[model samples]
Target: MKLLLLNLIFLSGSAAAVELNADGILNSLIDEFVSCVNDSAGPIHQAAMRLFWLLVPINLVISGIRCVFNGDFSDFFFSLVTSVLFTGIFYYLLSHDYAIGKSIIDSFVTMVDDDYMGPSELIDLVFNIDRQINNLMTSNVLGLVSKLQIVICMIVFSVVMFFVILRFVSIYLTAQILCVIGVFVLGFGGLKATRYLAVNYLKLLISKGLELITVLIITKTGCRILNDVIDATKLYEEGLSVLKHSECMVMIFISLFIFVLSKSLPPVMSSLMSGTSGGFETGLGLSLKKYRFLISRNSGK
Candidate 1:
C-alpha cells in the first residue's frame, strides 16, 4: 500500500511526466465501464419494459375505474397521458445508458465556488505535496517529533484522497444502475398509489447528484487540506513549536470529516429537496444547493 501511494498515478515524480494509458487509468476504462453497465442493464431494462407494457394498461383501467367513481374525467385523461409520456422518457434514458447523467454531475461539480481548486489544480497540489514529503525526509530539517507529524498527516490525508476517488466511482456506478431501472420506477406513475415511487426515484437522482458534488467538493477545494500540509511544513522549517507547527490533528479532523460524514450530505440535501414544491420541474430537480440556504435566508428577510 505504501509503495502504491509513493507511485500513485498523479503522485509520481512529476505531474506532466505521465499519461493515463491502457496500463493505468485509461479513457477506455470509462467507455468500457459504461458499456459493461449498459450490457448488464440490458436484460433488466427489457424485463422492466415488458412488465410495464403488460401492467400499464391494467393500471390505467384501474385508474379509469377510480376516476368514474370519483367523477374525475379530467383526472383519468391526465393519468392516461402522463403514464405513457413518463414511461417513454424513462425508456429513452435507459436506452442511452444515461448519457446525460454524467453531464448532470459535471454541472454540479462546476457549480462549486469559483475560487476553489479544480481537478487539475488538485492533481498539481498532490504532486507538490509528494515532493514536499520527500524533501523533509531527505534533509536535516526538523526534530523527530516534527517529522512524525508529517507522517501522521500524510497517512490520514492519503486515506481521504483514496476514499474520494472510490466514492466517485461508486457514484458513477450507482447513477447508471438507477437510470436503467428507472423504467419501472417511472412506469409506476400510471397509478396514484404508486406515483410516489417515481417521484422518490427522481428525488434519489437529485440526491445522487448531491452525493457526487459533495465528495468532489470536499476533495477538490472544500477543506484546503493540501494547502494546510504545505503551510505546516514551512512553519516546521522555521523552528516553530513542534506541536504548533504540526497540523496532523487538523489533518485528521478534515480527513475524517470527508471520509465519514460526506455520506450524509446527500440525504441531508434530499430532505431539503423533499420540502420544495415541484422538485422535478425545477430543472435538474435542484438548484446548486450549496448556496440554497443563504438564498432562503435572504428571501425570508
Candidate 2:
C-alpha cells in the first residue's frame, strides 16, 4: 500500500511539473532565442569594429593627401573632425551592444508590448485559424463555400506574413552589414569611388529606414485586424453568428493587398536607390551629374 501511494504521489508531481513547464514554454523559448542571437553576433561585431579602427588612419592619410593636392584645406579639416567624431560615437555604441539593428528590433517589440508576438506566434495564429475553420466546417456550423473561403483567406494571410518576416530580416541584416563595411570601402577607394560609395550607402540607409517604417505600419495594422477576428471567434463560440461571407472576402482582400505591398515595395526601394525611377532622380545622382557638367564646361572654357 505504501508503494502504491508513493507511485500516486510521483504521478501527481509529474503532472504538476508538466503543467508549469507548458505555461512557461513560450517565454523560455523567446529568451533563449534572443540570447543565442546576441551571443552569435557579438564576435562578428567586435571583429568588424577592430577592422574599422585599423582602416581609419590609413584612410585619413590618403584623404588628406588628395585634399591637399586638390587645394581643399578646409575640406580636409572638416573631414578629419567628422571622421573622428563618427568613429568615437560608433565605437562607444557598438561596445555597449547597441547596434542600429538591435535598436530597430527593440523599437518594434516595444511598439506592440512586452508580450509581442513574433513570426512564430503569427504562424501559430494562422494554424489556429485554419483549425477553427476546419472544426466549424466539420460540425456543419458553416456553409461549405463559406468555410472554404475562410480557409483560403487564412492561408493567404499566413503566406504574406511569412514573406514579410523573411524580407524584413534579410533587409535588416543586409543594411547592418553594409553600414559596417561601407565606411572602410569609401575611405580607402579613390575620389570617384568614394563619391559613388557615399551615394550608395546613403541610399541603403534611407531604404532600410523606410523598410522598418513599413514593417511597423503593417504589424500594427495586421495585429488590430487579427484581434478583431479573434474576438469574432470568441463571439461565435458563445453561439453568436460570425465568419460571414463578406468578412471572409474582406479578409482575403486585405491579405492580398499586404502581400502585394510586401512584394512590390522592395523593388521600388531598389529602383529609388539606384536613381532608375522614370524621370525621378535621387539627389545624389542629380548632384553627381551637375558636378560633371560644371567640370566639363569649365574645362572647355
Candidate 1 per-residue C-alpha lDDT over 1-301 given as tens digits, one digit per residue, 9 for 90 to 100: 2333334455444344445542334233344445545775657656656755666678778868877998855556655665566556655654554455556655776787367564344545555665776576666564554666677777767667556555555665576667665555665554445656767777777777777666667656534766877787776556663434435567667666766655666556646657666545234323333245465568679
Error of 1 at 146 (Å): 5.9
lDDT of each: 0.59, 0.54
Highest-TM-score candidate: 1
Among residues 3 or more apart in sequence or in different chains, the pairs in candidate 2 whose N, CA or C atoms overlap within 3 Å are none
Clash-forming residue pairs, model 1: none
Worst 10 residues of 1 by lDDT: 281-290
Model 2 agreement with the true structure over 26-82: per-residue lDDT tens digits: 334334334434555655556656655666676678768877998855557655655
